[model samples]
Target: MNDYVRGSAWRVPVTACQPRPLSAFLSRNAQRRPASAIRSLLPLEQEPGMISLLAGKPNPATFPIEEIAVKVRLPDDASSPVVVAVTGDRLQKALQYGPTAGTPALVDWLAQLTSSLHGRPLPAQSSDSTKPWQLAVGNGSQDLIVKAFEVILDSGDTALLQSPTYPGVLPALCVGQVNTVAVESDEAGIRADALERMLARWDVDEKTSSLARPKLLYMVPTASNPTGTSTSLDRKRALLRLARKYDFLLFEDDPYYHLSFEEATPSLFALDGQDSDHDQGRVLRFESLSKVMSAGLRIGFVAGPSVLVDAINKYTATSHLQVSGVSQCVAIAVLEQMGHRGFLQHAARTADFYRRRRDAFERIAHEILRAEPPVAEWTSPGGGMFLWLRLLLPLNANTAEGDSFALISTQARRAGVLAVPGVAFLASSGGTSTYVRVSFSLIGEEDTAEAFRRLRRVILDL
Candidate 1:
């Protein structure tokens, strides 16, 4: 139990961040991970005139499916649909086995998108130890996030995550036998002041005293899943400072980055070291196309230091290999037609759709749930697709505020409308909380008011 500081001198002039040594972060297993024999040679096949029998790629003549034509709707609802076709070499690559990292066209496009949006240079490659920051495509952000925890943390290692996190990521963290500690959150994501105070008293805090210091901190900075709250830019800078002060990388699982109701807030990835004046690769950003694009396509990516990304690539090589080449082909084809500006404009349109839905849902919710003796209350979300309600319930023995687990699952289910119980989002024992999460992403406006009334009945019945 020692401090994350060194000699009490933690300041650097505003300049290009010096890369932290790979040794500081990588786990023993990641260090020993062997390169895939065939995957390693896959890159060499691209050299000019390099006629060599290096790969066992199947001849395309033996395969079926010649061309891929996908019908895409315009971002403007008024515009007619257009068809995007992938043919010739592009189609061949789509049908054929591709690189382990991703289809070069798709991965490069994502890197360029990140550079444009985050205000960083395209993935830097250098002979120096400045471990180039790069992006690696994955089946989904979930796939890469699980693999990341495996690469950086060992069995006894600790990882801090904002409480009431996305429940889907919990199983992955649990599998590694890694300690997942909850840092209390607020209406605006992670409580930075509380986090700083907790870190400062790490050795003395009963919950963390005997455990390992955190190697990573997990957060869904924009539109956090269950909370439906987005962190402000100023708050983001404060969290970045803590990451710098306490030598831990921030795992920004941002599936809702593009779904923000307002202009997207700058991520920890972009502000990695703005406060500390050094960007030592403290942010490992996991981006997803699931929300904005088709979730079935399973397109997501990790944008961070090449050191961690290469480890993820190694995991990819051994696990699912890569995201569907055909999926990448379809996505990249549509993206190309849209171009960067068009793609962003389309995302904005998508955000607007959700924004309207959120407003309608909340308006109806407040009308019913807040009448007389209030049945529930919540902070309206700034972004994302959920309305997190604090269900007021009769106090019980274990919980000062009654739990939502039974009520949400049993009563709400019987009422013919169901929402996720707050207990599911928690990682600790006795998952008790007064919150329940409901989404406004799908239900039509016509059914919006009715849904809240049914929910109101269920809560009142309790």
Candidate 2:
């Protein structure tokens, strides 16, 4: 495909910035991958007055299931749950096989949502044609992320991500024989200045010179997984500048974009257009419906350059085939009823729900852990489900900063409190950290106090 694949226009930011060619980044596997023969023709079956024969698609009539109904409560109201149902042609679409990209109805809705939210043009709406950008739905964001890693990075290639990164992406790296490199992160996520210093001296840096230049820089960006640190607009602009200058795609794994304590946080995907010189497709964003809707539904979508999105869809064709048809149908129906505005309203409610939990968690921690000189320190999350606590445990000579592994694992477990060891999130660190990640999403308001009380007792004993 050409670097600047011109696309037919749509109603959204129909003429966004031209994207840079991904030729430099695509793995050898992606370059040689041919289109799936059967899945390639799946779209033709949808055209008017066509499709008598296709693959061994089972008859929906034979399936005993008749309907899929979902009950959902309103964002503001707690009184009643509204029942959303899928039937007729929609039901048929749900029962049978689906297009490789996604159920058309769901994909269209997501495309529209992405375009409107991101201020980017609608990608040319077809599989056969090419465009600078496109969208593909997946089983979940993690599913699409794995495929992206497979398609983009080959053996011995390097993947750069923030220290204390999401553990989910680590396992995926094994497939590509990739080298994991961690850049330090502060309270606002990955430090752009630190990255700038490293990249400026890439060849001279003995530790990095042997490895290939990083083709992708992955980040959670908003309410980061273990740190709960969110980058501001200025911070994001600085990072985008770095991505532009460094010539690496920004792989934004932003499941919590809609779950912010404040207004909807614009993703790197949404902000790329604001930088005039920044290439539009340099930011490939993976978004999940799991945080806002249902995790078991296993629904997520990727929105970015068409070449990359297509690469992932091709992988999906051979793997899971497509996201659950019923899940897509159910999502489409619920979203159709809610509309775009209603969806945001629901997201606001979800954010507020977590925010309350965070507040209660913070208050309890302050009372128990901060009673004396303070047993631990943490930044209260702006959004998302976590509280990252930096415990002030007794320090050893080897770990001047202190280590939470033993304290959080053995000691804390014995004290009846559990949190993810900070080392689990680091790629290179030798399991040394004074940090532990706790979730404020599930615990009740009443239980917050005792949870910290247990931790305080553990700290005092040690």
Candidate 3:
């Protein structure tokens, strides 16, 4: 009876549950793994009056660089620039090998930052009680995404993913031999009806009968890649209810959370933490500095239940050892210079920059693609860099259904325009699609009209 409460947000009973022990879900390889001897000793060095003779880290004094300075362009002018510097102790940390989890200062700063942003309680150091959550730094969110899969999946384990999802995740899923089930989506992102139906019939369905019931649901919720759609607050609550019903973990990969052109919706992580009785166990959220700050820095942080984070850290210990110390140090210096308020202000400016690009790109698309006897249709994105276009093309011999592959790879390329064919984002291979993904992120302002013009010509010819 403790597991059910009536008349909550779902119009269904809220399920009171605890996360399954992480050890029960870890892969065989992860279960057999050992901690890095050097990494284990890193904590002893922190004790007062203690000196480390252990790690083979090269002396920072041997490094040649004395200081590093970064020039940040002003959002409005670009004529005036501000300089942020890394020197003294910070510079020393940059040049040396650091802790596998991350540098202490950056880790603590991100912990507080995430807590404030997501409305969650800060994780405490003591382990006597059930610690609600923790954070881990990775080379990038992409790196963390792969590791998360490794931690949870065996060779044939199943995972539920949104349709037309981020293409980057496909290869990682393949590498882990994880089976992916696609959940349908609409303009507001993943549809709860489709997801609920899939889960309800999973065990009895012939297609999924042999496959293990999925324990994880991977989603990009805000400004989903390729689709350019965001999940609404009502939809998020519905999805979380399904997650509770199915007892599955939700991986919220939200790199574009801060890049919304309109007001942002509450994230699944934030929503899950809203319950006063539960801190968080069902949602693991990822954040990145790539889009907001610098992609080249390759700094990202993951926040979730401590049990899951501990497994990810164990994998990190043996794998990359740690993210590049120089990268983390550079990130920390820039973040400190910006401070919390300034960082948010910078995010708003970045969003405005993309909003301009989206406006110009959409105007051209409407003029060219939405003419008499329209050649294509698309959703105007509220945020992020992509425009997902469903092309109106004739059916070919290769596919009974209209597909964009030849039009994009062959015809569009010859016409001097590039776009990713939609089939690449599907859960399974060799499917036909009339959709294509066009990006406005790095495309030039002057070339927007011409690019769409060329694409229109190609479609008209087809």
Candidate 4:
């Protein structure tokens, strides 16, 4: 035994000690590595105007910007249709070579907003010695989502996901050839008991045992897709504990965090800040302006420890170069204009819109379709744009013996309603689920009643 491992403290440490040099540790990561071509020029990008051999960034001149206008038609009683002009130097930036991490102004604005809204420590990036929080921009949160997966998930590596997860993640994971293990979820997002059970016996699960150990937990903490559920603060804490205990990353997919039905469900990031030794560095959070603003803009961001973010950004460098300069500039301009309070108000507006739709849908379903209430149960999402419905159809109904996929595809479509099937969201051969996902965001007010009526009929027939 070494002297460091001696006396009264002569007892062996209960926890395993595994440490490696930063370079050695990183070299082990095969998933994300900066491309050789890009790595060679890092120092050059910092060099003083040396008339460069560098990024093949598009010439700003090629971008056409004859005119850009946004017309708002809000309710008459509400604030007069606010229309802001976009021109001058602003228009030029929107049509030029922008920052790699995002427009500096936009990055700064977002950092401030995240710090204030989530109540996280604002790292000072100036004369003050505080560690500055870094930022990276991407084309919509979806772009960031794919990049995050690329950064850590090796082909065949295990990724823990919530049961009845976001259907969007399915295709991406399939393309990556990654193995996912579903953790049963309840009204409060992923269930701690179920996660503990799955993780505890991971090495023994026939389906998962052959794959590389799971290094990530993918979850949408607020208004989860296919199952509009938000995990409570206590649940969040338990999850953090589990992550720390098992040594894995927590991918907090929280695009809908701001849309919570409650005044505050409190973000994992926010709660992590409460403790001094809080290794919040484990949770990588994702957000987007798509749900809050317009999905067309394709602007999104992720927040995590500098090391992980750097790894993901390196992938971004070789893959997409950077999110569009125009988009970043526009986002910055709009975000700066909205500020913090205005942004919150706008978020509330978005939430209010969805909540109303949810109530209407639930009311119609209860009155017309659900013969027994608890027989077909679903969490009333506190926020976001989805309502995951778990129907009470026979597990082995018709020729099919699983999800509402066949019914929705044939009957519902024939009946003129389209909803995502639950099986589409699960791991292949995971299990049978009598669930279906519905989105209120895409539908209009006048069409809601008819859509529900169609959906109700399909369930009644089942």
User: What tens-digit string does per-residue lDDT give for candidate 3 at 1-462?
Assistant: 333211111111223245444455566666777878788788898899998788887877789999889886645445878887888987887788788789888998898888888888888778713678889999899999889888877777788899988888899888887888898999988998888887777767898766776768899998899888898899898988888766678999999988888788888988988876643578889889999998998998898878788888889998888999888887887777667777888899899999998998888889878887788999998889999999999877877768998889999999998899999999867687999999999887568878888888898897
Give the lDDT of residue 224 in candidate 1: 91
- For all candidates in order, the CA lDDT equals 0.81, 0.80, 0.82, 0.69
Clash totals, every prediction: 0, 0, 0, 5
Model 2 clash pairs are: none
What ranges in model 1 sit over 4 Å off?
Answer: 1-20, 76-78, 125-131, 273-277
TM-score, per-candidate, Cα-based = 0.93, 0.92, 0.93, 0.84
Best-to-worst lDDT order: 3, 1, 2, 4
Between prediction 1 and prediction 2, the one with superior lDDT is 1
lDDT of 1 by residue, 139-160 (tens): 9899899999888877777789
Q: Compare candidates 2 and 4 on lDDT and give the better one.
A: 2
**Candidate 2 per-residue lDDT over residues 1-462, each given as its tens digit:** 213221111011112233346664677777778878898887787689995587888987788888888887766565788898888888987888888899877888888888898888787655534676788998899999999998888887778888879988888886557887888888777888888787777767998877666778999988889787887777787878777766678899999988888655567888886666546668889999999988998999998877788788888887778888888888889888888888888888888888888888888888888999689989878889998888898878988988889888898898888889888898654568788898988887667788888889898888
Task: List where candidate 2 sits over 4 angstroms from the true fold.
Answer: 1-20, 76-78, 126-129, 263-265, 275-278
TM-score of predicted structure 2: 0.92
lDDT head-to-head 2 vs 3, winner: 3
The Cα error of candidate 3 at residue 76, in Å, is 10
180 Cα displacement, candidate 3 (Å): 0.5
Native-referenced Cα lDDT, model 2 = 0.80
- Residues 1-462, model 4: lDDT tens digits: 211221111111122123211122121233335464854465466667777767666775676775455644233324666564567777776676555567767777888888887787666665311243455777877788787777666565667888778777777788877777778888777898878776676667886556555667889888787677788788888887777666567888888877777767777777766666645566778899888787888889877666666666677766676788766766666666666777778878878887888787777656655555333557677777777787677556432535687778899899998888777888555466677877877676557768777777777776
**lDDT score, residue 127, model 3?**
73
